[model samples]
Target chain A: MDTVCSINNLARCLVEGGFSPDLANLLTLLGGVVLVATIPLVTVIFLIWIERKVAARVQDRLGPNRVGPVGLLQTVADALKMLTKEDITPTGADKFIYNLAPVIAFATVILMWAVVPFTPLHIGADVGIGVLYFMAVASIGTVKIMVAGWSSNNKYALLGAFRTIAQLLSYEVPLVLSLLIPVMLAGTMSLQGITEAQGGMWYLFIAPVAAFLFYVANLAETGRAPFDLLEAESEIIAGYNIEYSGFKWGMFMASEFLHAFTAALFFAIIFMGGWWGPFVQEVPLLGALYLVGKTAIVYVFGLVLRATVPRVRIDQLMALNWKFLVPLAIANVLVIAFLIQVLKALGLMPVPGADIIAHLPMTVVMLLGNLVIIAVAMQVLRNQGREEKMAQEARMAARQQRVVKEVRTPAGAPVGD
Target chain B: MLEFNASTVAFVVMTLFILGGALGVVTTRNLIHATLYLILSLFGVAGYFVLLSAPFLAAVQVLVYIGAIAILIVFAVMLTRSMTRMSEILNGQWLLSAIVGAGLFLLLVIGVILPTWGNGGLLDATVSAPSQVVIDTVDLGKALVDRNGFVLPFEVASLLLTAAMIGAIVIARDDTE
Candidate 1:
């Protein structure tokens, strides 16, 4: 007689209605699956409209308003249009793999929701290794890109896939490294466990550097602004999905948009004390509201950044990941690990399940540690920038000197022009 | 005593994926097709790890094998112009490879299977039921770093990997620079 509409309660109701226990359980399980799967798919339609509206606002233009109220039904109209569009398979394409790529791409994102804790009592599956489950499912996306690129029988598609893979693979290093911070703090990889561990204090306050690293890496992972080289329309002509059309192409777009919002949701859950507002325990549904509110804030921040920032060059993207984010992330993890040990030895470590006030000392110390690391990293980056600028100036001076020498000689051209 | 359960059906499906993908890998003429088939086979192995109730191992399998290694293999194949399309599936060293593969398979059968041939049961003696044991990931992490556990070998393996990475960088360095 539980009031909550949870799977267990539903199963119990079915059992009381004369169904066998196993059959009731099976039906409830199926219903839960449908519920979990459809939530993302349904929400993604609205997410698209929101993304367009936000982007429009950022660029000082009105977004879709022709369809329903504030263009709310625009995504639905687009979906219908996509449905009626011609589905074309290019000549010389690997038809089977080509067709399967979009399905895998879209399915991989949805699979991640299987472990997401929407509320305290409403997780799809409380997998033991939920964080790793996310990482594993995301990794499958690389395979989909490869399959799509290779099977498309288009050079642009292949090249796009190659660049996208490089970006995705490189960012995954920092992404996984930053993910370790929360896992270490929580002492568990399960998303629910992490959320529960954040009850006392959000990890964002304890380890803002890790949160930043995770956010940046995820931005690159999702191919958002400054890292959207995967589909640099001016360069590779739509990249990996260039050969796709109709609903197949639409699926890729949906997954991309959905993946961005999913990253935000994970950020909220892991770092921002997901569903942990006041009275969340008393009203479980309030937890869902709090989670969504936090997620929307993060998601809108991402959209604004996307609209504002220009895309980075491939070389710059690689250099940033390798030289900047990866080292910073590694150092952040090591520093946090060391600080935790120091706090433990000093007997200043907050006990598990302590209140927020009890966590203040540890939070302050960890926050100071993060600020120090950030300071040091910023100083190092400034020095590197100065050195590179000096070298560029010196090279320019030498080039000018050579030009002058060539002008005086008039017979000999520049040696290495 | 085996019941017709969900896991049994899943196992059958996973076996089909593994065997079918492996067969496709060796039989396909297209190198990219072969790589895709190899990914399918690796995914099947990950499925088996899940069935074994080692979700951590399964995630690692997908993350490392399919995500990193398979992508590397595909990258290498794409880089080589002539490797994408193979004129023939078999090479002149097929006989040698076949002999080596068969010998290794036989060795596995002897080394692994022969010891437990007539035991209480093959699977029962090897793999405990999922409900029988629960190994938390925290314990696994502790075991990797514990002084009484595998700390030494773990550090050595990490050092070896670092050295190998440095070696790769050196070999791939541009001489023109």
Candidate 2:
């Protein structure tokens, strides 16, 4: 389902609707943004409701059931609670950043919402550099988290902020590199352009390994389990958001939900053919509806992952990324490039033959090669963990030997010792 | 000169943002304030870029400048010892610089407006001529991956990134090592 909605599909849909493709594209972009913001906001509210209901089911208890037929109004009631809660400011905190953090976090993710070209026509600003736009803006969320953490002036908050920053910085690299494959395959940075190129076949079919890596990297980015070591409540005590309360916290929560949606949206754009519903592609209204429905379903996949998975350990997490993802990403880039060249030469791929690369089949072969890289990376990281453990044991032994030497005469010197 | 439209109004405001930010950068005594203002200024510049239909450039400006460089400057400032000073933002060099800045601003404004007085005809004729080189993103992208695609300069950009990475490692690592 996560296939590219080619430009032909987009144009066909637009023309059928009696609109110019370019003009439809502009309108689509504007609508896509509004959809991006509104859909996520609505999704977040819905998710919050679903989360409580799920928690109730897990605990074997009935959840909020009084207001508006089986407690559907429960989430609304929660919002009202937040609205009435008194705003608080710590005596010794940076007022500027403290206030700005939530706003920035809430806002930066929306910029990301715009770059994704939905149904090819109802897109955001389909600039030539859409992917770059996504990459550039996504990281700004770090500053927001950092500011939120720093302004809190609490130790736990500080460490949480640091961890969040570190997590984002590390995962962002692999995420970018993995996504680069689709770009390399499509040979364009624009979201719409890439989708259009893939009209022949979804990059996922050819670049399965890249797609897998992208999903994992993105899951980590969205702070889902197996990667969400930053905000482990048992470890960091609410991470960088410990100090936030009331509406400020609501904004942060809203941003997180939005992030989750956008992450899913990007993944859907890459993997699921965005707006490629059955008769929806050629039909006008049905296509738009299908696109939104598909996107939301993609979003739900992440939410389910969050509900199901458990967070991984921090050191283990960092090691998995540094020793595994980075190498795989670098290798992936090289293999794709070489494969593209070979495919061009062999007159197989439709790529300009004069470049004289190999064929499309060769490109597919190179992409398949990633599974081997993933297996190797997994093995390498497992070995790396063993080495780190051995090193740690050696240090502990040396410290124990020092204590033994220093304590030789202490037996008779002091009972307390 | 030419009167403004909605976009032109936006452009003027954006220009002010960059100018004010630039002014803040040079004039402000508090480096942190300067950094904040710099973020503001770059943000304005980005708005200007968007207005000019170069969304990519604007996005890059925000990403590289506001996200990376400005944050780095703030981080560096925090590491320095003089961060605690709470005083008036301006100091000794500000007064002199302000006078010079004002004069330069006046001169530029005059230079721009002066062209409208009959002499603007020369500028209009020059502007009306058809541009030989088409400037667009696709053209730029073609220039990028074009085998002969300005590869030399692109390589230089990569080289700069490498140097910066090395510099970051040196500056950020604990010196005790």
Candidate 3:
């Protein structure tokens, strides 16, 4: 009974008033991309300010109050200073990598924004393998770090480059493993799908240890304390960045902080249940805001920790990775895998131990296993302290006997007989 | 008159890059500079993969070529620092050899660029087909495992890489005994 509507009518429905559907999609995509890229830069500046204040307050200082009305514009002033400064390259340096290294390091982080989904409508590239794509891009920055260090041809730079490699290798496994826990629960890699999976229950409740591991591993990955051996300021004198000056040095500092923020953002996305709060779906676009807010909270937490803690030694860092975190990660992965398998074996479809209680043992095993490990490690520490005390007393007794004999006999000190 | 589109633009750009890189590699005195130019050239080709609507391949190009191969080249240059510090020009009758090489290179460039001059019928035929097709990574992995497009080659390549890796490790061993 209805006549056929015109093609323009259908097109108008799709266009929603502005441009043709195809062109409109492209425009919206470009706009979303601009917003995504701009968000990190803006967040980095604001975070630096927050960090400055948080750091000052933690150490009982007044903080940055010189720039604008309680130092609100301090980062802006810093940015302007960096922008106006001279870019220097050493004479013997490889000019190409020397110039390109900072840009590549910065751009690697920015390009990763393409894979991060902001909202349902506002996504960068909705590729099939977005999560892996992000990991790949993030890892490329390590290459840039190495190149910058080696190309500088300074011994400090070479040492820093080697430390950078070791750090990346150590932390990458645990970080990726902690991330896999959430992905296992969510059952998908798509950011949208992962968020949707968190609607009923966030993975944080089921796996708090994974969240802790993620934070620690991310700090290490970004070369921040207590894992900043590559940038061990006292020992190596600014590490890989010793040869860099002015804007180039500024770029490394900026990249370091920005990468930390980006990892914090990812940690918030996966573990903290991005942008979802109690009854937040009532507001249409509040999810994106909530996500940003949660991520910023995590970023602030990282900055606070960085300011509060002193950097750990390189040996301690390597020991923590190889001895502790790696074992924990392996256990977590096996637990997750076994739980999924047991759940599938039983009639229970999604929830592993919903009805039968068969998978309860596995879940209990994971949590209790980690707890037991922590207890045993503490006991081992106490025992080692006791042993060291005894050893110290024995050494002191031997030294005293030698001194007494020498005092009595004057020259030969043969008082043992 | 040459009609230009995205594909044409990308092809011209990549061709320029490949030729320029080969020239630089051959002519540059500094080994490190040659490696840098090689990376620049690879990146230009990767950009063409993007223009061809194969962003995945473009990404792989940069990751494998610049990230891996170019890095290896630069590392070798650093490791052999003593050997790379010679004069820019080679001693003993280098200019004569260079001139002859340049003449031959010019002939090849002219032969390709001005195809109307003597490329026969190759210039007239429009290349309607894409030069390369992008297979998705998951699909590529499946194909490599499932014996359709890539299984044999994949196994062969993996074996080759394993052999090379082992050889290098063995050769670099400390030989304490």
Best by DockQ: 1
Winner by TM-score between candidate 3 and candidate 2 = 2
- In model 3, which regions exceed 4 Å deviation? A1-29, A151-153, A279-282, A349-417, B1-170
Model 1 C-alpha lDDT per residue in residues A1-417, reported as the tens digit of each score: 545555558988887788999888889989999999999999999999999999999989999999999999999999999999999999999999999999999999999999989888889998989999999999998998999998999999999999999999999999999999999899889999999999999999999999999999999989999899889999999999999999999999999999999999999999998888999888887999999999999999999999999888999999999999999999999999999999999998887789999999999999999999999999999999999999999999999999989778866645765
Candidates' C-alpha lDDT: 0.92, 0.73, 0.73
Model 2 lDDT per residue over A282-345, tens place: 6745645655676678666665666677788878788778877777888888877777777668
* Candidates sorted by lDDT, best first: 1, 2, 3
Error of 3 at A161 (Å): 3.4
Number of clashing pairs per prediction, in order: 0, 25, 1
Q: lDDT of candidate 3 vs native?
A: 0.73
For candidate 1 chain A, the 10 contiguous residues with the lowest summed lDDT are A1-10
True contact recovery of candidate 3: 0.11
lDDT of 3 by residue, A142-248 (tens): 77777788679788887887777678767877877787777777666666667666665556655767887888988998887778888887888777878888778
DockQ of structure 1: 0.85
Residue runs of model 2 more than 4 Å from their true location after superposition? A1-36, A53-71, A153-155, A288-298, A308-317, A350-363, A385-417, B23-33, B81-85, B88-134, B145-149, B174-177
What DockQ, between 0 and 1, does each candidate earn? 0.85, 0.51, 0.19
Alpha carbon lDDT of residue A87, candidate 3?
70
